[model samples]
Target: MTRDRFSYLAPWWLPGGNAQTIWAARAARRHFGPAPRWQRSRWDTPDGDFIDVDEALHASAPQAPLLVLFHGLEGSSASQYAVAFADFAAAHGLAYAVPHFRGCSGEINHAPRAYHSGDFSEIDWILRRFAHENPSRPLLAVGVSLGGNALMRWAGEMEQSATQLVCAIAAVSSPLDLAAGGYAIGRGFNRVVYTRMFMGTMVPKALQKLEQHPGLFKREALLAARDLYEFDNLFTAPLHGFRDTVDYWTRASAKPVLHRIRVPALALNARNDPFVPAASLPTLQDAGPSVTLWQPAHGGHVGFPVSHGPFGLPGHVRAMPEAVGNWLLAQL
Candidate 1:
């Protein structure tokens, strides 16, 4: 697929439109139904508190390969994409799991730490535990947006030797450069749309934490902050031990780690992604033998819908689950 810049500017309602606006608007609709049924469990971390993982099983076969799914920032097991993927997996007799990041499982983490776009340690913890417990079963992974970046980074750092159980991996619309992604979204119309919605959800959480812990975060800075950068700089960056947002973005972006992956991995990026700048193209030099950077002509962040029906139906999004599921299953 050719990475066309003009394609990204197309309107979202258009069939196969790759504009970031269209993608964001679809996600904003909230028309998707409740997540599919799944079994929820709390995995006690080495830190004492729990990280929640939701397992959706299609069969009881002891040797069935398990596909572990992860959601985007602030998403839980109930995210639309996660649930849709689970439903797709069920039809194929594939078992899956979605792990909620540290404080996102309706219960605040005991420590001040929360999840960010590039937190691979949490993934490492989950995968190791899952592999150790299910020695005979193979493990695969897929993540969306922020979660995608985390999974990709984890797979890359593994060097394909760390885990004999892992087979294939897929990541969609992950912002390889945090600073660039933030800058792209922090402008003109997009800035308002993104910041307002994101802050509305995040600020309340920060306030709740402040209420519980009293002095855990910067009350004044968080109160005055209006964008993700400000919020992260004051609350997320400091709490995560970064000196500044720029520093965090530099270290947390997955671009530096892409070349290290040794397993079959696919990265899907949309040039029209309003959140990530067009300048941050696939670093061809960094790609390895096992990596396939699938830069489609257009896909607004995650809106790869194949139709113009109500709620992006009858097209790409619906078809993607089957495609992704089949691809992963083939790898196993």
Candidate 2:
């Protein structure tokens, strides 16, 4: 793995990590761009539940590389990063798809099990199916945040076999060490702001899941849960077959197994990312020869807003997707 100097820098106005992260995400959501005419497909799992995939098809480029995106915790196809990547795919004429994790695509999943960060079995099944269906097209996967960690785990688990399934893989702002990230997000300012925002949606969805399968977990405990660790322990960990949050986090983290990844892969994280700490990021010696670590100084979380030209005009919320897209294509 090469610890190359990343080429992304936030504008002068976006000073802190939290500021850069929040501002860029909001800005992207507000700005107008080409929204993909998404063709939604529901694929049934071996279990009774189903997963939804939103695709932007290109029949003209019959054998174009398929870009599969895996969204973060509580994220969907319409997520800011997901939409940005969809725009990039449309502009480049690449076939694109965003696979929503179980219970994440508006509809709650039928099974007792919900998605988690270390759910590589689900990732394996999804990617393998895509490979089988589009045998002619090279598969390239990009996962954001939670999804990224899960995808990296899948790559490591599959090892050399991963190369046959996908030509290249990229992860954006993934918390490689889930324990550190989980701890970080649950404390101080992150807890009050980010945790509250996530819980606003997650808690409701979890309750709905409980309604689907009565006696799943204790209702009072679930409601009392304040942060991710508490919430994961109350809902996510138990539902996903984990003993507790620590067990889930330890087993799910991608850092311990990063050296096992054999495919041409990129793990892009910002040194200033609020969710993922710079100390937790993997070094060149920590990864295999196939991995490249792009730890830029300014990009916060998945946010990579750029300032360009002489005047340093600051209107580039789409920079990370463009850079990631270019890197993925270069592997082919």
Best by lDDT: 2
Q: What is the TM-score of each candidate against the true structure?
A: 0.87, 0.96
lDDT of each: 0.72, 0.88
Which residue runs does candidate 1 get wrong by more than 4 Å? 1-12, 15-35, 163-165, 308-316
Full-model lDDT, candidate 2: 0.88
lDDT of 2 by residue, 67-89 (tens): 99999989988888888888788
After superposition, the stretches of candidate 2 with alpha carbons farther than 4 Å from their true spots are 29-33, 57-60, 308-314
**What local lDDT does model 2 show for residue 330?**
94
Clashes of each: 3, 0
Worst 10 residues of 2 by lDDT: 27-36
| Pairs clashing within candidate 1 | 305-316, 306-315, 306-316
RMSD, each candidate, Å? 3.8, 1.8
Tens digits of per-residue lDDT for model 1, 64-86? 77888878877777765676677
